[model samples]
Target: MSKIGVVLLNMGGPDSLSAVEPFLYNLFSDHDIIEIPRLIQKPVARLIAKLRAEKTKHYYEVMGGKSPQREQTEQQAKALQNVLGENYKVVVAMRYWHPFTEEALRELFTEDISKIVLLPMYPQYSKTTTGSSFNEFERVFKRFPQVPVIRIISYHNHPAYIRAMVENIKEHLQSWESYFFLFTAHSLPVQVIKRGDPYKDQTEETVKLIMEHFPEVSYALGYQSKIGPVKWLEPFTDKLIEELIKSGVKRLALIPVSFVCEHSETLYELDVQYKSLAESLGVESFVRIPTLKDHPSFIEALRQLVISSLQ
Candidate 1:
């Protein structure tokens, strides 16, 4: 008869343009994300953040001067809380920005909870995403070892999750026959994959699972949002768009398979940048299947994961 705590983990974004630099600093400072030696990480992070802040701020400005991810994740938390009812308290623990994992743990420790569930917003597992968040959690959790923790690592192939994505995609499609599906995920450096990260494989598996429902539909997987000049998971999404357009594929449907919420990557990169690129290449129609943000099925999927973890 004790309360359960559910903490949703995500890579938080700046709430406003002013917060952009610090957010970037926090992100780059994380050793799990930007691999730098402990001695010079902060200095390098500061320099990188300073260099990128203006351009990054412009990206956010184009998307209404802030990232919608925090709001979307909070709404998802509320929805999940409602689904779980009074017995569970759901909160978000963002890795890089405000409402950070430290803050989330502080709030949950104050609650009369019996156990805590650490659920990453990412469906696919990657050291840079879920692993980074978990590392932060473990650092903060040292303060409250008495409260048992249950970690739901990637649920990439979870039936409920796959069903939610499939359902969302189905609802958005006018006719599956006319559109060429492109499954695009946030790209990681190729070095990360070589280091034994399961991200690439898991992402591919998620796409494979979702595509099972649309056997006849033409689809290809691509990677987007690569940082710096490092070789990332290929083929790059922008290049893929060009390839498809040149190949006589005029109508395309882009699916952000790795993301569960709308953020800069989806809103600006996919919606504006990629859309513009596709249009410039004479793509007749470019549709982006929306991320499953608090969709009823997605909420149900979260609820099921929590319930199963409890048992």
Candidate 2:
């Protein structure tokens, strides 16, 4: 039997504080991110990375000098591998850091795999996430086009994924009373949307589907992780939290909707930074629903996605 390769894609984070700068340089250098001419973007990306490296290092320092994304992603990859059986090989491909897509592709090319399944870890399709990863994958896989590639673009509304998210949320919340739900997604620059990115819409769809499972739960949607002066999707999660607090909402539940696994954004950004913000705003309870990393239903969803793609 020919080996089936399953490639899981994600925006890889720096493994340690020292690698953060170069990782940022790689990230900002990507056309999908900076969206400028190569010559100009390269130097600009370097400058930005150099300027931000110190501050970014502090973030990693607080999180124990590294990001947990690679570990968490490996956990998901391992789970998928187990479910897919011995004949299947699962690869974890990160966009900007170690074990990059190129490395994964090279490794797979040497293997006895007959076909490749590209399953992006991002549940929603976005030019920045899945699109970027696909673009890179295509560029590398050009060398082995004979090995057919099946891509699963997005599974934002997949039943198993939605169920896993709902279950994770229910498992986290100690009580449903007096708490309002906030479905938070990572924010993208407004210009990205103007350029016809469907990320926001797909994220909304995910929210709507999850909302269906909680008709009695009062919930709202917002964006997070905005950087720089650029106008990002609004109302921002922090501002929305403030609004909820001013409106006499004492308890708040936050769900990192776009993220399927815990990373710096969830741990440092939402848990540490946003938690502090919520407390300062007089929020009595700030509950952040965990990401769906290695959840049985989520792994099942990945299996289904691969099965459908192979067909």
Candidate 3:
């Protein structure tokens, strides 16, 4: 059989509080996620993971102590397989959580797979997310003598992706009026920006395209979920919201553009905490738009990406 396999990659979150430490350990140990020098990588990684796990668990607990990443990725994988026709098999592979990259790679070994494709759900090319997943994947593949020859579908920032995002915004915004079109993506530390990571720039470009597509979006593009004192992209979403309230903007429509599937960040951090903060600041209305999962354009984008990679 001329086997063709697609590995759908993502940064996985813990499913429970007990899993938090190990989950974060995997995330922190990756040089792509945290650049602790090789000399003290293990020790520093353990320490950071242990520390961050506590706070991260709180975020998860607030949103029912888990994230929908695994299920969402599985759904996407099934959908992609359908779109790619019955021949292409796609596997959900995560960096830190369940259906781990190692496990996914092992699954490939059992199959008659020859040509494989790597697909990161992340639209933005970030060393911290897609790069990190690929780095781990390479590590796993090196263990095998004849690793299935693979081609990678790099970030597909095509017009279809932009249209999917814009369509979601337009559909959701139809019900609201006089609200700020707040575009929020996952935040990367400022150090990454200084180190020449293109995540920030790519995000900004997406914002530009969305704006071009929808001229009515008086949106402010900002980053969210920055941890620690290390400077992150600003104006940060929370700070931006507060600033907007101060500037007399009473209504807001926030969308987590970086996240295509709902997660703790979107559920609790944005929905609950940010909503509470906005309410306290005397803002009358604050709503968060859901991610565009199973949206026709998004699935079509994935299908196009897979087909393009195959050829």
Candidate 4:
């Protein structure tokens, strides 16, 4: 029987402090992430990576000197493979680090694979994330074009995915009425949205679908992980937190709406940095609902998506 290859695409993080600079370089070098003239892109990436290495490394150090994204993604792949049985081979392709799209393609090409499914781990479609990964795959797939491929662009409002999000939020809710829910996603530049990226709209739709489970709960959407000075999707997560506190919102529950796994954004930025900011602002109870990392419902959601794509 011919095996079906399932590739999970994600933006990988440095495995250790030593890999930080190169990882950032790889990230910035991608035109999809940072638009720059092709002739000077590498130089610019190198310079930015060098300047940001120390600060980025410091964040990694606090989180045990590495990122858990690779491991978490691998676990998810394993779960997916088990669910898929022997007829399917599930692999992970990290965009900016090791186990890249090329590596994943090579691995699957070695198998008796008849078809491939490109599944970006991102729920919301963004040029910076899913578009970048798909573009990378296209670039690398040139050498290995034997197998047919199907791509899942986005599942922001897929029923199974929406169920998973609702279930995750329900698992973490304590005082649903008292705690104000803040759904936070990775911020993108306003320019990107202006250029017609569907990320912002899809993220809002995901929030809407998840909120159907709790009509009585008060919730708002915010963006996190803003970089540089460019205007990004707002209100920013940190700013929103402060606003909530000033408005007498004593309790807040932060939801990682766009992320499926815990990474620097969720672990350090949201858990450590934003948590500190909230406490300092005199918020009584601040809770960050965990990402849907291999949650049974989320795994089931992936399984359903993969199965549907194959049909």
Every model's Cα RMSD, please? 1.0, 1.2, 1.9, 0.9
Across 175-233, the per-residue lDDT of candidate 1 in tens digits comes to: 87789999999999999999999999999999999989999889999999888877889
Give lDDT for model 2: 0.90
Better of 1 and 3 by TM-score: 1
Model 2, 1-311: lDDT tens digits are: 67999999999999998899999999989998777888799899999999999999988999999989999999999999999998899998999998988788777766688888999989999989999999998887776647878889899989988988988888889886557999899999999999999999999999999989888888899998888888899999989988999999899999999998888889898989989989998998889988999999899999988988877
Comparison by TM-score, 1 against 2, better one = 1
lDDT of 1 at 68: 91
Clashing pairs in 4: none
Ranking by lDDT: 1, 4, 2, 3
What are the models' TM-scores? 0.98, 0.97, 0.93, 0.98
Residues 208-271, model 4: lDDT tens digits = 9888888888899999988887788899989999998999999999999989998999999999
Candidate 3, poorest ten consecutive residues by summed lDDT: 147-156
Candidate models: Cα lDDT each = 0.93, 0.90, 0.81, 0.92
Candidate number that wins on lDDT, 1 or 3: 1
* Model 3 TM-score on a 0 to 1 scale: 0.93
Candidate 4 stretches with Cα past 4 Å from truth are: none
Residue 265, candidate 3: C-alpha displacement in angstroms: 2.0
Q: Highest lDDT: which candidate?
A: 1
Per-residue error for 155 in candidate 3, Å, reads: 3.8
